[model samples]
Target: MSDWEEDWDNGDSKATSKPYNKRNNAKDNSISNRSDESGRHRSSENRAPIRYPQAGEKRSNGQRHKHSEKIEVPSDLVGMLIGRGGANIQRIQNDYNVRVDLDKESGTATINGNTEQNVKDAYNDIEHHLNNGPGSRYNSKDGSSGHQSNAIYNFQLKGRNNKPGDTDDIEMDPSGVIDWEALNKKAKKERAARWSKLPELRKDFYNEDPEVANLTPREVARLREENNNITVSRVFQQENVSENIPNPVWKFEQCFSAYPDLLEEIYKQDFRKPSPIQSQAWPILLKGEDMIGIAQTGTGKTLAFLLPAMIHTEYQLTPRSQRKGPNVLVLAPTRELALQIEKEVNKYSFRGMKAVCVYGGGNRREQISVVKGGVEIIICTPGRLNDLIEAEVIDVTSITYLILDEADRMLDMGFEPQIRKVLLDIRPDRQTVMTSATWPPGVRRLAQSYMSNPIQVCVGSLDLAATHTVKQVIEIMDDGDKFYKIREFVRNMGKDDKAIVFCGKKTRADDLSSDLTLEGYMCACIHGSREQSDREQAIADITSGHIKLLIATDVASRGLDIEDITHVINFDFPRNIEEYVHRVGRTGRAGRSGTSISFITREDWGVAKELISILEEADQEVPIDLRNMAERFKSMKDRRANESSKFNDRDGNSGSRGYRGGGGAGGRGRRDRY
Candidate 1:
């Protein structure tokens, strides 16, 4: 039997079973503000946008209050302060019967009530809740704690101090703007301190937890190369099971019974066993429940959601007479992932359901025609979808099943506007599913707002990082030496093994590809800078095995799904550890063994050390020297933070001055590597 772990909510996939609702009663207080997060807040709305209000706006009351007297808060948090649909705010007003006026623009609040005690108590409660609560935090990692972060030791209200004769807290004027320079300086000091503590925080990854770290590099590589005792079955198995596990198989069998022919077609394709994500997700999605799938790449996530999407579409599929509606709409962060999804959907959507891939960069006219012709399943990136929506070329209301693949990346790439706009336009009764590699706080908030009691299915935690087929090696050297070593490695790779080289920038990818090609290594480069045609052609060449070596940025790092990828080379180390994982994940796919080598220069040691820590957490070996370099950076960063904090105490603005020793202005232009 294939090792399978089912998602809890999959047993009840019907959309009506779990209605999306807000937990908080107060509208303005709906968004929980964490104390440690400096003024950032989490909203209850399915979509949250950072809103900064202008000063001098009229208050809710007929009276206008001076702007400088009240504390300034981020606008997004204000909505939460008011109860659901403003009912909470009304209740507060009606209970105490206070004439409190909030001037959103100036961040000033005025209270006129029968009793000063009631008004003061209510206002203080609001302040206290925001300053210290699950919703508000000063230093919590997930921004869900009550304690103020260590970064703000002397944080104070904006209009706290006043001389008897000084006209400091005046009427709505340009004065009390929360001392932006001072706040920024304090934030910088705190961030530096937090980053410096990364080494200490890594204890969770290495503290005698076998699940966190198991094998050293030598043992893993030796075992992998020897093709020793370990078998695929041994590597993959369901360790923990209980009688309480839901009867999802029966539920799925019942829902999918009508489509015997489709089920036969699925099994005929030789996908005899469902992957972990697929096993759970397929049943739930087929039942039409909102879901949040947390699985890493290469865990068969595409098929997990696709199978159900296809099955659901087929069951409710309309004939060409009702072809104007879209049965399924899959939104991906990148064109590559979108296209990959379209391809997979097309394979399964064989019974009259048309699958279309729409994204920017290609010929829009042809794409427009494809969309207009009739497509049951549409896979697209937010940007192109928004363009088509704006042009009124496509109707999004007909979309029923919405899948946001790589959900975290969509948020990170700043697709909030487009995503919000699209979600607003879609039918409220649709089934939505979001999937991502990592679950951050922002992503969680998004899920809470958009998905209804989503079955949160996480295949493997950070402890079990990546699949075992990948061989990760980190080489530390000077910049020039690193490049030379890369050249040497490229020359030494087996001729039969295909390689993909990842760089941090388009220019670097192009430059390296040019240099490597001139040196007689067959290579093709792809990045955002290239035209749409060129990118597609480059990817086509790589997939066809026409190009043995492919160079790209993080663009091609996700969702390419080309089989037989033997090696992945990090010509330039990724800035973030998450990106590093995605880049390396391209190899060791389809049950094939692969090798990934990263060239870490002296300058990159800081980042490399974190990667090594992550690898160590995954039971991958880490070289000793790289660890030392990371420690050095941590120490340097700590000393700098301490010194900067002291300087800020004296000068009142250390952060804006920039890095420790360098003139603050000089550090702003450090993107010279590009």
Candidate 2:
């Protein structure tokens, strides 16, 4: 056996049963003739370690020991053992008088029964019944079974496929062929008896529902309350389609057809429909027009510009025989986000197009090697990319396609200087495309400075943040009780549901995640201070479903795109109204409906008011109390602006200055972080 297999067998989980074959005796007159035959072993030797059964290893005395022998079972047979509500499993356990504990969270089960032999016998019986179809051996018509003696009886083990060696020889004798009619009669009688007593086994599992059992008492109550408030008719209530439809200046459908393989891959991954942003942005970008798309994260923004970038590269790429520098460059805000965009872009850039991802915090030597090898598409974070550019490790002169994803976050992270340098280093006639979740004044000004005659595309209203799939809710609570409320909500979440908690500052994000971990929640905190490797692992943990809760600062608010985040909790309200939308947008993604809940405190009344005003302008329903509170803050807005130095002098640098739109390519405006 391989070392990996031995290691798995030695774990707390072990298998049962070895393979054996039996043949009729030749000398016996009542039996048939004997023939030489070969059968395959269904035990550990034939199965891969990855799919090894994770049940029945420990003894009742709480002693854990490894079994020298191993058992092998088919994958289909294993699935049957875990019958509807695990009914078949219960029968075998009761018959053998053992205890079974299945841990779905760990993806393993434990069998605690007295002694090794009894546990082994129970496993064999369970395996035997499951190996056969429903209602054939253990399960009856309704998938039930009867209580029977738990004895480890011998049965010929068979493999799904026959042995390789040919065996056509058959020894025939009059005594060997005797009694086929009598055997059929006995088999029919045994089946009838088993069927009559199967109800007890069926009832044990038929009434069991894992979904209900998995939910906590609080979650069950919340689920019931949500359903009770709506009637069947009300649930299907439809709103009239708005007439103010967005008109795109350009549209192209067959553009991606040239790369049929790329399209097939996208569809195979189940991204069936193009998002509003993608539908609008693809045409302008494919036409080689500089454009900026303003849409929230989790709305397929990556693919919006990515498809166009890929399409353009198809025409502009250099011949494979001749090596060249990167023709397309994509710069994102954070390391995690840059890597994510790289992964998405690589999924489609096949057929001779070389795409490579470059980021900081690993091995710089490895990154340099990739750049030296020559790639047409480059996905990189600003700081790392800039370092490479400065060191002359990467050539940017050939770059004609420049994409700035999460432009707002990139600017916030002080990448403006690095962005300006990249622009200067790249081709003069380059097509620039910038995307952001929300188009605030800061992002608009940055676009004006960089893009030339660009077409602007915005999905939905600027005030309406996140996607329609995300249900938004604001709950008023005292500052002191906010933590408790959040804790209670998390405790009520279903096993499959995941939640991201957003905090205002990095320190707060770290503290909250730490606190949650200590409180028995599997969570990880991500922020600027964390190393790049750790950040990558943290994002992977959340994306791979290993960690259910993620606490992060605004660094996670934008940039990072993880699919199917069931909920987003705003532990601390955003500083700006635009950020409020980005924070909640993470939850509802990839066409899945999600929920966002924010705990509004007295200290956050100002920010809460602004958020409601934005939502109201976007045509969303707003509470009367929130609207009134928001109104109080608005009355003092102008007074506070006048007193502040930001707006004191219009002509002064470092103050709020009105935008003086730039002419030609790369306009200019007031400098702000996002």
Candidate 3:
């Protein structure tokens, strides 16, 4: 016999000498005698009779009987609960002063004791053993507790919380004492109650004007069909909105009549209807609510926010002499974007509202004079705006409407401090609107810090990838082969086809432009280092068909709308996927088909997986070589993560002696082999 078996037998003998054990022995003898007298019929009387020992009965025999509790154990856990030859069961019975009887066929264990508390304690012990396995001890305070049962269940269900080759799931608590199902039901009820109180959409009400009436059912159906067919998607007043806010209008004529002159201007521009961004952003801004507009490039985001600002200013117009400063301030990231916005401003700046553009490399005195001459709208870059504000040439205290265009680009170009300074100097109750092509973390932080209860409006999926309107051609080649490939592509193109080649550095652009021009190709270059006049001339030449080929940096990637550009070439990959999206967006404007080609090399391995994912999502054909490179990169990344975790587990510090002696050398060896 094993040591545990011998000890258990001796324990039973020692226990029989005690008075309580003696009383239990006598009761067992009486039951056995009754069973013998009943013979084979005893099997039919399996149910035990309920008996409650009174105080008087306890005095007679120095013992008492209480109610018995039955607990069903899982069939697989029967052996672990009973132990070898039933030693563990007997140990629990002796320690807790209870009777534990197991029905092997049904897997039911009935525990009886002198009191209810004793029965509960015995059941708790049995549960702990079953959960922790056969090696676990009874009456041990270190076992699983009630609070950790839910976490344990979740761990088991998920099969190793995070990574493979990990046994962390088995280490969680296994007490099984908590009622998880009841808790989950209660949480679901609370969620349902919260959703029941959400605001309902009032589709009939058009605007706050009392003259507009609710639309009929037939009209509503027609409007919905138009919206769906045109792909105009919108989410209105998402969070913390008042109950009285109305749904957005579908047609430009439905809402544009409030400003008849603006409607006339729209018709004069040959605009048939509002774009998706305009259709959604108009009503929210009209209601005087702060908003963040997210849409793809070349989708008319400029006019989306501009028209509403003009309408609001026209509604609260005062005499020119009485106006303190510009009523609306539009901030752009680049001088080119600022100029474009100013041009659009002129189209809708009717009704005696003057608009001016301010940027660097322009005459500072002239900009100062324009601001002093009392314009209703001022469009400028962040740097020039900050300079004018510090110079005290412009007063922003009276500004009521603030707009930040290309907001993500501004944050990317290290303009946050200047943007924040201008925001701080403006009026406290200004209705701020921010528009971006993508919503990175920095843009979200800026919105939370400055705006008040802003509504987010996304016109389409928020993907920082090139649109399907542009055909993407990906080529995997070495750095030395890029020039040869570009030469071949340019020779194959028609003489009148316009193309813009993008490079990573200013010096590279200048060098490439000089080489191409010397080789008898009409090419020009533009970057931040070039004079503003030179850059302006380059853009003008490209637009007027004087220069068919242009090499530039990321400055021209955004907000420069050239109409008939047929193709875009990325001679060098961009810093990220977002920049790549903008660089290719220069083409595919105004519903015209275009093409973009990229030269990806081995140095671009870090972003290979992301590039493949973007192309896949856009339904573009991916090259086989790039797919293999992405797979290799993923495997390398996962291996490094596993090695780092192992090192951290061995020693708290990665550079510790133990880790260096073990995982560090192994990692170096693996890298060498690779």
Question: Candidate 1: global Cα-lDDT?
Answer: 0.61
Write candidate 2's Cα lDDT for 456-575 as tens digits: 766655554546677788887655677788789889999889989987667767777777789998998887666667777889899899999898877677666777799999887776
TM-score of each: 0.62, 0.56, 0.63
Model 1 RMSD in angstroms: 17.7
> lDDT tens digits, residues 1-674, model 3?
32112211221111111122333322211111112212322321252332223222322334556768888777767766655444456546645668776665666788878878768877877775565553333222555443254244434444211222232334323542344466577556755665454322111212543223376645534543554222222223345545343354656776777677778888898877777677667777877878888877788889988887877666654544666677889998877788788888888747888988987766767888888877989998776676566556778876778999999988877678778878877755678899998988999889988887677877556766676788888999766777778888877878768999998778778878887787788888987777777888998899899988889888888878886888999998887888889988898886777899999876666678888877887799999998887776667667767888788888876732322211222332321100
lDDT of each: 0.61, 0.59, 0.68
Tens digit per residue, CA lDDT, model 1, 1-674: 00000100211011111222345322332222212113333222342321222345443435432222244445656664553465434544544445445667666555555555656655654564355434454324443234332112224333222111222322211421134356677666765664453211100110122421354655544532343121111111225732111112312333345666666667666754555666455545655557777777877888777766766565553443654556678888776787788777666645777888887666668888988888778888776676676556678876767888998877777665667778877765668888888888778777776765566666656332555679998877545665577688778878688899888777788788888888998888877666667877888898898988898888887888887889888887886778888888899886778888888765665575568667886677888888887777677677777888888898887563344221121332344432
Ranking by lDDT: 3, 1, 2
Number of the candidate with higher lDDT, 1 or 3: 3
The regions of model 3 sitting more than 4 angstroms off are 1-246, 642-652, 655-674
Clashes of each: 29, 5, 0
Question: Which structure among the candidates has the greatest TM-score?
Answer: 3
Best model number under lDDT: 3
